[model samples]
Target: YRAFERKYRKNLKALYLVHPTNFIRLALQVFKPFVSAKFGRKVMYISDLSELNQHIRLDQLCIPNAVDEYDAQLLAKEKKPSAAASNAFQLNSTENGKALLETQQFGVSLAFIKENNGGEVIPPIMKTCLEYIS
Candidate 1:
């Protein structure tokens, strides 16, 4: 961000952040003092693509298929029952829990992949990367 500001400060307009979870918002708040009000005001938190569309044309950008899928997952999760959703946050005490506490690679947690992917086997590339890193 500092480098971008240094080079493109004059031409820089709004910085739109989509799908910003609580963690992202909290981190920005923590660094609020370091960011100038002018720059901060130019930053916008867009909840989803529809909100983003109001600001700019979505067709102009090359959005990844994974992003669309993830956004759809987020929407579906929101529509689900609160009880069903809470299961993901429950404490894991099984064997998977033990592994989850240990396995992390490339900023992706084993627990997250397991929970999200319905306990399916990890992809070959991820498995290979984990093996090499370990």
Candidate 2:
């Protein structure tokens, strides 16, 4: 996967890890050090169909039944709640005063998020990207 991912890195727009398992997530973390910082950000974990829809247009997508069934099982486990937290984005405040982001394929997709007044930059070009978030 690492080699395959690197080979197609240039043309790759986005990579959605549909129905990810804990083992898969851990494997990614173990190999994260070998990958580029920017490359690591390319991975995004989508647990179910609805979450996938937010990032992609469903009409253009094709999901297998096995994937859907796996998602349903995970969803069921989530509804009942478990001691372990599900895959999610988290902000960590460290002693050094650095805010670290913890996520699976969790990186800021866009250089700029929202402005002070909840508005995105027009044209959506590289130059319009904000340099700092804080």
Candidate 3:
């Protein structure tokens, strides 16, 4: 990190960290005092892709598929309900509950997939398999 920083510090504009975990947060907090204030200011802890997209165009980056998958997982986790709410949902017998369940494929919403794919409904079989395995 030091060598890279030394070489590119002058040219670098910002260093964005997407989906920073708790360990990363703790490390940054511990090492922050050692780094220059200017360098510290340049470090941006991005919570999600949407936040990173605001600073730079995602098309320009050669992001890995795993990174995208991880970001999606993080987003899904954030949107997931509490244990009590999930139990309530499981017990629900209303048509609305069924409709809501249908809308969710894997962790991603069917509406989201349709919107991204020009109104086409894509089968989310992978999620069903994953759920079964878990």
Candidate 4:
């Protein structure tokens, strides 16, 4: 583990423990101190591949999982469409159409969050956005 750290030092941004086996989890825990000391607070644990993908940046080479409600909320907030612009452009201009298209693509890409049946509730606009992205 130290050797791995030495080789990848500073270049490592996040540590992903994917559905780790018990032994691996234990090993990870043992190395947690070292990792934290080396990488600071960038470690994140994820149970699903999609969650890992979404949380990690695109340039990091991980394909995102379908967006969840929380993810949708963040994306919606980040890419929220301006109501005034929506009315004026309405997919008519090339740029507006492209922006709308990108938002829609991201929305649909997150649709799977609706299927996960957790007790967590989702908002209507988020659902609509997910459908659009899909």
Candidate 1 collision pairs: none
Q: What is the Cα-based lDDT of residue 84 in candidate 3?
A: 88
List clash counts for every candidate, in order.
0, 1, 0, 5
List candidate 4 segments past 4 Å from native. 5-7, 33-40, 57-134
TM-score of 4: 0.33
Better of 1 and 4 by lDDT: 1
- The top-ranked prediction according to TM-score is 3
Please write out the lDDT profile of model 2 over residues 1-134, one tens digit for every residue: 45675558777767899878899999999999997777678889987888999998888978777877887888887787443333232332221354544431223322223332246454244334544432
Ranking by TM-score: 3, 1, 2, 4
User: For model 1, where is the 10-residue window of minimal lDDT?
Assistant: 93-102
Candidate 4 displacement at residue 94 in angstroms:
45
Checking candidate 3 for backbone clashes, the offending pairs are none
Q: lDDT per residue, candidate 1, 1-134, as tens digits?
A: 68785668766799999999999999999998999888888889998888889999999988899889888898887777587545644444234445334345433465556767756688556778899999
Q: Would you list the C-alpha lDDT of every candidate in the order shown? A: 0.76, 0.65, 0.77, 0.58
- lDDT, candidate 3, 20-84, per-residue tens: 88999899999999998988888899998989999999999999999999999988998988998
Poorly placed runs, candidate 2 (over 4 Å): 1-7, 77-134
Q: Is candidate 2 or candidate 3 better by lDDT?
A: 3
